[model samples]
Target: MGAGLARFARNRMALFGAAILLGLLLLVLATPALFPGDPFRLVGPALQPPGGRFLLGTDTLGRDVAAQIAYGARTSLLIGVGATLGAILFGVIVGGLAGYYRGAVEIVLMRVTEFFQTIPAFVLAILIVAILSPSVTSEIIAIAAVSWPGIARLVRGEFAALGGREFILACTGLGASDARIIFRHMLPNCTAPIIAVGSLLIGTAILIEAGLAFLGLGDPNVMSWGLIISAGRAVLRSAWWICTFPGIAILLTVLAINLVGDGLNEALNPRLRER
Candidate 1:
């Protein structure tokens, strides 16, 4: 872990990305104190430019844009982490089973995973969220539903490759239980790529969540960056601050995630480290 951290610190772009994510986490934690009032409340004249009483100006409803942005960080973090974990968890399980026990099991599981991969991810997320209630929970589940297929395939490939290795063969020769060989042995070996891929998935999940919110499928009860953008589409020409700030936030967050993912791949991948 210490060596990995040293390697990660050496990558300037990844360091910058890590800094961005750290700042975002701090913002999410400080949101309630920094903007205590309800973000949705009308605070002043609508379409106010960025400055004066409100740092980021006001939305059409006179809600403080800064407040919305701060609060929206919470939504993004929540949904991003939540959705990624759900997807990775299910994916590891399904993929583990398929790869660890090939033949009929692999065929069946891989076929199901391929079925999901054939669908356009965003369209599938939209359909799922539209069918279910449009809320934070729904958003997480929707994003996870679309995300798991890729994860499953990745894990399956990792397991298949590792299965032929001497350590796995030796473990099997000792009559180790399937559960032990998988969870205690195989899963640990495959975590480097899994972590790299999972980091990227969080960024993807956030983008999907934002897209859903932009289309008005977001929870009416909460204020997300996308919801703010949606509210500003009508007055986009005049009060650009409303959408602009949040758009930048989403863009920066996703970019940071991607950079961090690259860093993790480099630090965690032994082949990369050797090179």
Candidate 2:
């Protein structure tokens, strides 16, 4: 673990990404204590621009924008992490099976995967959310349902590639069970791609959650960046801070996640490994 950390630290871009992500996560975790009173507390006047009392300003509802943003970090992180975990779990299981076992099983699973892949994730998430009602739980489920196909396909490819290696055949010759071979041997080799994809998926999940909230399909009780943006849209001309701050938060987060993912991809499987 220390060596791994050292390697990660050596990559400046990845380290920067990690720092940003960690800081954001810590902020999310500490929001409750950092902000006094409720995020929805109408202590200030509505549409108050940035000033002495309200640093980031207040929304039309007289809520503190900075407080709301702090609370929003929690919501966005929760949704993003939750949805990504769901996708990774289901995608790994399904993809592992389809890749390890050929014949009818692979055909059926791949066909289902392909079908899901054909539909646009945003549209599918929207349809699912619409059916399930507009809430955070429904939104997470919707995003998870649509997000797994790409990961499944990537996992399948990785598994298939690993399967052809001589070491796998050697394990087979030793009379190892299929389960052991797949789980112990092949799965370990798939870690590089899994880690890389997971980083990217986190960003995608955050974006999806934001979009859902923007469309009014978010948790009503929670303070999310998307919800703030949505609320600000109506008073954009007068209360630009409503949307501006949250939008900036979202953009920075997504960019940081992508940078980390890209850096990890390059670091984990260097050009030397390809040779």
lDDT of 2 at 65: 95
Backbone Cα, N, C clashes tallied per candidate: 0, 0
Q: Per-residue lDDT of 1-275 in model 1, one digit per residue for the tens?
A: 68988999999999999999999999989988998888888889988898788898988888899999999999998999999999999999999999989999999999999999999999999999999979999999999999998889989999999999999999999999999999899999989889999999999999999999999898989999999999999998888788899999999999999999999999998889998
Question: What TM-score would each prediction reach against the true structure?
Answer: 0.98, 0.94
The most accurate candidate by TM-score is 1
For 37-67, candidate 2 gives per-residue lDDT tens digits of 7898797788889989889999988999999
For the record, the alpha-carbon RMSD of candidate 2 to the native fold, in angstroms, is 1.7
lDDT of each: 0.93, 0.87
Against the hidden true structure, what lDDT does model 2 obtain?
0.87
lDDT at position 7, candidate 2: 62
Q: Report residue 55 deviation for candidate 2 (angstroms).
A: 0.9
